[model samples]
Target: MTDQDAGPGPGRTPRLPPRWFVRSAWVVHRGYYRVTGGRRGLWRPQPDKWGTLLLRTTGRRSGQEHAVIVAYFEDGANLVTLAMNGWAAPEPAWWLNLRAEPDAAVVMRDGPRDVRAREAEGEERERHWATFRQLGTDVDGFSVRRPHTAVVVLEPR
Candidate 1:
């Protein structure tokens, strides 16, 4: 677990880190992961609660491969994540890429696998959100600050 998640109970919403801090850390994090060949930075979570996965998606406009380390939790055999851009107002690029092309790849501790992404809706969204809440996350609090907070499910192909 990281320091960000070490303090108080999950019910207390932690302040979002500064954008500059997050961007700076992301640069270092990507560099470390590239240098370690997936041996390091493979299980990083922001709050250090949920598991991590390396999600690769095709850039919607660039048509280039883009990989991002994302926090995720397993729901049955599927992986669930939020399309929250560091809690920023803008939507995440990976989620946009997935919307353009649902087919993607994810690297987990087990290994890499092809997967299909879909936004959970209605009952499914509620179910997943409830599960996150049960994990002690203040999902509604953070989600309310943004226009869109998609609940994404990645299913193995």
Candidate 2:
């Protein structure tokens, strides 16, 4: 089966590692950050429609800060993230970290914002999922993934 089809199997879980890939991606991302002086570069689109941000949160176990790139959707007064990737089932490390410690920080072109993370439910989940689809194309199947895929909402703390 392909990576996307390889849902969670026995003893298999979604994880972000493989040291080599992580390190290489980090190097490239860091270089992009430096070249842009933390303003905008590789990741940011000229007229960025979908809000993208750098999330910083403390590790639950290590008590250290971790940062990641994530897309956000505005929900009245909150921002939401869609944890979708074309590989494996189950949540990723970033979502796990947020669950462990809801208090987090986000940096966008506008500025930094203190936020709290929570998984969306019921109508809220459906609303944000629709907004997510409007922000991009070819993600119609995201919400249907059900209990596995989650809409993580981040509100001002």
Candidate 3:
């Protein structure tokens, strides 16, 4: 199997706890958002409002669409998200699904739109990293821990 297929190992186990935390927070936030009609503004405490966006990507194996909310940073006309938390691991499930099917949909606070997912590299990655660092203050120590991060840009279709 390739390195990606090998999945997480012993050294990566600690990262799992953080992933669980993020997932639980997402669940609670979504529930709160539904309860408040998206007015609570308790989802993400960041500058830019950085509110959660629901991304729908096709399942790699099941060929069905799966939707999940994630924190995102905007760049001009593109929407960017990082694979830093367990959700953003080198072999994250959503990232893998996007790889299999780049076309997806994103529902932000504004509205929903069809988008194409692409992994950012070189200068684009650097630019988004800076933006994320500027907007994400709650994620303390994220920069130190996830220095080598992958940026995924979603362009509207």
Candidate 4:
């Protein structure tokens, strides 16, 4: 079949890392932060690179804290990230937790800060998506495989 007819073949873009690798990398990333005592494994976005931070949220059902390392950019004091499960159909668990409880925290290279998680809407989302695209994110390619991707904003609380 032609590439167009293939239609994401296995329902995921060939460009995205496999789900297993994604999960494994996430585990390693978190472990690095813990092993180093939070001295590493996070960074701020730069002109040539996407920044990453540790996002912490309280589970809606378990009442325990859940942490995930997320790539993000700063818009003033607010941090913006995509609610993408490594381009999978389902949103990341931390994003779901944020939806249930807006209050959260993030640890950056500089320090940790209390913040509130929110989904950007309308022009706001478009603006952030534009930034992602400009930063070389495969927004269009990966998005075609998923129903929706949210632009999550973490504002200081």
Candidate 5:
């Protein structure tokens, strides 16, 4: 059987690593932050390439805090990020959490701040997405794999 056709033995459904890896990454991030006391491991190094930010969102249903290390870029006072889940089928949990609660927090090299999240649409999405594409990140290749990808904007509240 092909990889996609393979099932967990007989009765069980296929298990995927993309979702599990999401959790694993969060664990590693948290561990590093604890060890470094927020001095290091909290954010990416300078000249952030596409830049990086620590997005802290509240779970929509569980009401628990979830943190994800997201690659982002600054747009004046706003921070922009994509909701692409490694070009996978489903959107990232953090994005889903933001949908439920737009109020969130972010950690950058400078410090942490309160922010509000919104999904870009129409010309706004096109404009920001173009900026992302110009940065030389593989936005097109991965984005094509999914039906829709959200351009998220975080503004300080």
Candidate 6:
């Protein structure tokens, strides 16, 4: 379980890839979007699957724009995603920025959207997490590796 998940027997979680590999992948993914002028990077969320979306947030300290590709799904008019950081220990920078300034933007297959970010709480959090499980995301398994993770909800603003 990558020396993280706590369990009696063998952990169900798979060993995560190396940190350098994960970071490199993120850079490449963003590069692909820019190189293609976003013609090929954005994707739509499916009922039974998560989809890719480019989330843009303002830097908390620098006040500059930062973007990241994250997996998300529709929850009615809102979009929901996990701050997974590729299953790494550190929180994703995009999520950190959202925490600082809730207002953000996203580009999906449909078009761009302005959104306000907030943490899903209590029942809401459980419901969305359940949806992730149902979609075969193995969220619980992956989350065992982190001390805490945020279930972020992006409401249209």
lDDT of 1: 0.83
Worst 10 residues of 4 by lDDT: 4-13
Best by lDDT: 6
TM of each candidate vs. truth: 0.84, 0.71, 0.71, 0.90, 0.77, 0.91
- For each of the candidates, give the backbone clash count: 0, 0, 1, 0, 1, 0
lDDT of 1 by residue, 8-94 (tens): 455434566788988777778778888998888776333436777889999999999999988788887899999987777899999
Root-mean-square deviation of each candidate, in angstroms? Answer: 5.4, 6.2, 7.2, 3.1, 6.8, 2.5
Better of 2 and 5 by lDDT: 5
Question: lDDT per residue, candidate 2, 1-157, as tens digits?
Answer: 5433454444334334554785577557756766887776323323325666788888878989987777675667687787663323556677888889989998876778899989999998888767766776334443334357777999998
Candidate 5 TM-score, C-alpha based: 0.77
- Among all windows of 10 consecutive residues in model 3, the one with the lowest summed lDDT is 7-16
lDDT of 3 by residue, 1-157 (tens): 5433343453232223455687788678768766887666334325655646878889999999886777786777888887555434355667789989999998777777899999999997877777766774334344334545568999989
**Residues 47-101, candidate 6, lDDT per residue (tens digit)?**
7888999999999999999999998999999999999898877888888999999
List the lowest-lDDT window of 10 residues for candidate 6.
1-10
| Ten contiguous residues minimizing lDDT sum, candidate 2 | 40-49
Off by over 4 Å in 1: 1-14, 44-48
Per-residue lDDT value at 110 in model 5 = 92
Which of candidates 2 and 6 reaches a greater lDDT? Answer: 6
Error of 1 at 65 (Å): 0.2
Q: Candidate 3 — what's its lDDT? A: 0.70
- Winner on lDDT between 3 and 6 is 6
Cα displacement (Å) at residue 75, model 5: 0.5
Looking at model 3, the pairs that clash are 83-88
Clashing pairs in 1: none
